[model samples]
Target: MTSQHAILTAEAHRDLTIRTERAAALGDAAMCCITVPDEFRAVQSEYPILFRLSDTRDRFTALAMFGFENGENLFLEDGRWDARYRPLAIEIQPFLIGGSPTDDGIGQVHIDLSSPRIDQGGQGERLFDTMGRPTPYLDRVAGLLGTLDQGYRAAPDFFAALQRHDLLEPFTLDVTLDDGSRNQLVGFHIIAEDRLATLDAGMLAELNAAGHLLPIYMAIASLEQFGELVGRRNRRIAHGRG
Candidate 1:
């Protein structure tokens, strides 16, 4: 939950510093939610990008599958992420674009002051320079937050497209590690290839024109990464790292 949020202006946070270190503490099960339109290509190569219904089950959001279960992130070890590309959703941690306004504006950067990444002891990237201007790191974070905000706003339309086309379906994943332990991944949904194949030309054209086609295919391609996830899990178990 957000404990406090203020507009991230240089004046009020000139001395603030953000930890650039990898999130070793997030542990084995840090599943970060992602928006497909922006993060699909960035996430597809290294993570099994999947989808999950929102609490209301009214729409689905893409998820960068980090661990098999809560507190079990297979990609984290020795303070490093095992994959080459960490999803931006994971990269932008403890900081997010504000969803509501506080007399400033609706879309401004807000930092979770309680986040473990916040450090005033000067161990991380400084948010602003002596001139009270945003530092390069802060500038980069602002870009990330801006991209996230755009994706956040675009999410409803994307999901609405999926719902209109009836492309999503629930599927179960069962994996066996080297040690003979079985893991069944549940509650996740995927694009129904059959349904996608059966779409009429007019409907496909509509999805394509609305910029939903590529992301839909990207989600389909991401299913291949699930095999590689099993390999990572097997190695972790073999090396006593799981």
Candidate 2:
């Protein structure tokens, strides 16, 4: 569906109430989300970090994997996301940082009118109070958006560093379920531990000085979550829900 994005404003959305819940109906069943280096530490703890080329194939994006296939979010169960930390990209739903028309130094917040999170029945948290000031919920959302924007701006440098070091390599995952079913995941990239190991002390120091080493390690550590994720998918298959 085409998105209907409109600049958010208290005057236009004073009564808008956003439903803060995790459910498939609210568009929370994605298998992966675009991630940024700023949130890698938080995201790596809960999800496997992977990489893929952008649609234009001119840039790379980090991804937090939640499941093996499209529309299959294993973290989402029983109306909740069973994780300690969610990627900022997923948390900032229905709202996004949009470009300012006047080339001002400020970012504009835009809302997707087609989102199911829009609760016009007044059953959710209001975006603005009666006085037209942002409520605590909206304030929190704004903060999330701000962080996301910063993360996006910092991503290119991180990807470029990975490329310069030749640390990214294509990988394929083959999974076998208890039911004897096989699944293959292809066309994704991950930090090549072998290549990373080959980096000299000087290269390592350069990455560390640039604040890229920690996140690179975090992404590598996140591979351990793949076992847990596959277990979730296995359990779902056993329950007849996979």
Candidate 3:
């Protein structure tokens, strides 16, 4: 594990508390929105992991859907929609399922982190194994992951840019879940600052110069919606159990 991962793990073990409520009363029309601390957001934004669809532009949508991080199953009026595509039949394991601890010894927001059965070569390999050839969508997602991998590989320079501006800071985040009950989570929350906003202008300028920004954002939006669909399905599975 990297230092960043270690830090998050230690934070996860802390006894912080978060506020939560049961989702039962929400009656399938509400989405759980937890207010994460700026620190956590910063860390999340900076972490090398491409957990967010926006970060990778949705290239890993299929992988993310199978793994369980962000999806629509978490919020849907009806829970009978079958995912359009199912990721490779790899074992599904629940990662971080629960609330995060707050800085003030409180637990907040529910978190669930899971890993998909991505093969040794990552999505590309899984795609080949599952379909014999990569479809356009699969190829797109693969390309997106590739781009993100490149960006993460170049994080040293990215960090340098932030350091040059003297804007580097330790991060902390608090999560809250509203399930008609209250829960608390606390620990060492870490995230990189909104260095993205600062970098976006430059990044966008470069992308615009290269004529590849608008298309990228559009792709990202599509993937984000797809991930939401998966989340909604998962949520239905959860509620159906009750």
Candidate 4:
């Protein structure tokens, strides 16, 4: 089979399913729960981009999340994160669920396109052209998020093994913004400890060569705007309770 076919076959083996109800709840709630290794706590704590919520007594569950608004502005506010980083106006929403061995003992992370309010008129058309028709990249990203959930569920032990060995793999997901811009979200960059250090140097070099990283950075920067809005809602709720 061709390389693309092989990849699709492998992905098919996972049997992923997107839980729309759960995803919608998360968007309405505007939150996510991420579990990381205990050893990464200090790194996470120091990372201004991520916010830590709580940790399990065993220290295995380092619960934290990234505010959509914070994610939106991450790049623009600080171009240093990625030198090629630029600022864009897009929207991203994430949701997560966790459980133990019976349920695979692994937590699932899901991301959705809550909104993509771009001012440009041709944004969608541009993205469609870049990705090609039928199963566009935006839909594929959403599908992958669900697939990620299945992967986590199917092999929690394997995930832990990767974590123990410090051998996480990097992957990319593409999203089409409201403005017709296409955004790529790079994954498995372990926050402050490595940032982009662990990424494939060749890929980074290629991106640099192609000069497309800045726009991606800007797209991610757009997430911070969403994060801020969630923060505001949270604060209002807290104040009301107080």
- Tens digits of lDDT, candidate 1, 1-242: 34665667777778888776665553224655565566787788777777888889777888888767766677776777778987767777767887642234557788777676777747788988998888888888888877877777777788888888888999789887889999888998999999999999999999999888988888888889888888888888888886
- The prediction achieving the highest TM-score against the true structure is 2
- lDDT by residue (6-61, candidate 3, tens digit) is 21132342332121111222221222121111112222221211222225432121
Total clashes, candidate 4?
23
Cα lDDT computed for each candidate against the true fold: 0.78, 0.90, 0.29, 0.32
**Candidate ranking (TM-score, best to worst):** 2, 1, 3, 4
Q: Which of candidates 1 and 4 reaches a greater lDDT?
A: 1
- Which regions of candidate 2 are displaced past 4 Å? 100-104
Q: Residues 85-144, candidate 4, lDDT per residue (tens digit)?
A: 111101212222334435645344332223322113232321223223323543554454
Candidate 1 Cα errors over 4 Å, as ranges? 1-3, 26-29, 100-106
Write the residue-wise lDDT of candidate 2 on 137-220 in tens digits. 889999999998888877788999999998899989999988898877789999999999999999999999999999999999
lDDT (0-100) at residue 131 of candidate 3? 31
Model 4 regions more than 4 Å off = 1-74, 77-134, 154-242
TM-scores for candidates 1 onward, in order: 0.91, 0.96, 0.27, 0.24
Q: In lDDT terms, which candidate is top?
A: 2
Pairs in steric clash, model 2:
none
Judged by TM-score relative to the true structure, which candidate is superior, 3 or 4?
Answer: 3
Q: Lowest-lDDT window of 10 residues in candidate 1?
A: 24-33
What's the CA error at residue 72 for candidate 4, in Å? 9.4
Order of candidates by lDDT, top first? 2, 1, 4, 3
